[model samples]
Target: MRFSVLSFLTSAAAVSAAVIPSSSSAPEKRGGSISVTPHDSYSSSIGVLGCKINTNRAAYWPSSPDCNNICVKVSANGRSVNLLKVDQSGGAHDISYDAWNYLSTGKNATEAPTAGGGLAATYEDVPMSECAHLLKDGKHLAFAAANSMNFITSCSANTWVGKNYALYNILNTQCTWGYDELCRMPDPSQGNQPICEHTLGLTVALKTCPVYNIAYPTGKLSIAV
Candidate 1:
């Protein structure tokens, strides 16, 4: 896959405390000024995961305490397969695509809005037997008969949501959405295809930034701005 070299902003500053904002606060105006909560929740330094800063509620994806880290859930045949903890600073969408590529090709992949032949992104079928090799735990045999294709198909057909949540909200103080600016996200496909080819069975609605912090050891990641 083709990877876009996106430059991210960074500061040497470190946050002291992190807290989720209460839902009762009135919604900040969409596509307006972004407010930064002065706290130590975010760090310019990279962590176990690639999380950078604490995002506000309006922010698309939440930053993990660890920089570049992402949590993923893999499911097949309507049954939960495994929860994956990985690292990718490219954002949630890119990380998701990379996970798919690893499962399908057994090779590391990069971020790209398009795939082979510039077609909608797609992955190869990988049988569950091969999971042991491609996945971290090379010896689990629970879904051995199932294939990666089933997982991919299930992701695209069952879990995928359209474009990520809007990035022009208050929590996304750093990103400039409507105008072409440094942090603006790429436009999504009109066919409801995810920025990532498929979803990873994450419970949270896909967000524009796709960055996240893990909520639990299993299931979808619970991300907060």
Candidate 2:
């Protein structure tokens, strides 16, 4: 049997591209001991999501070149939040340019995203407005990032409702009921649950965003906040 040499080369290149880390700033550990505040006692109203990378194992590169699927620990401020391990089998699984752009560059509501390139911003520093852009994009990338960073699924719903959770605004809205089901904390009520933007702690898990800070030196499987 003859194997196609060109096909092997092409496959190798594709895999190389997927796994390689783009040139960018590596996360530096701040001078502080590792700390984790539990979700039950944690309290905050800022609505920020940060990704603490435990182990970047994903073939796809995140906005931060160093980021990978390796166990991302979601946190708000300095407290730890519980994340549901989701099976992204159904529906779409893609990260949009706009979402990727914001994640890589910390693009805010005011700034428009360019075509390509990565950013140095960690999940913690990424502004809420930039996150809003991702949430509003209504793509699987938004959902992926949300899940990675442990953003409240209901938060995405409220985002879909936009500024007040009043009218169902498609532009402001991101994911649908289907997306929410992907989360570990699905709406207990039958059918789709009502949009509750202002209400906090609607779901069993505490509200949180991504925390991209990783504990690099220890080589431990944890994203420190």
Question: lDDT values of the candidates?
Answer: 0.23, 0.23
When summed lDDT is taken over every stretch of 10 residues in candidate 2, the lowest stretch is 37-46
Distance from true position, residue 85, model 1, in Å?
Answer: 5.4
Report the backbone clash tally of model 2. 15
Residue 14 lDDT (model 1):
15
TM-score of model 1 (CA atoms): 0.21
Query: Residue 53 error for model 2, in Å?
Result: 13
What is the lDDT for 138 in model 2?
A: 24
lDDT of 2 by residue, 80-187 (tens): 222211111112211222233334344421254334322222222222333332222322232222212222222333232122212211110111111222222226
Give the lowest summed-lDDT range of ten residues in model 1.
140-149
Superposed model 2: Cα runs more than 4 Å off: 1-45, 49-213, 223-225
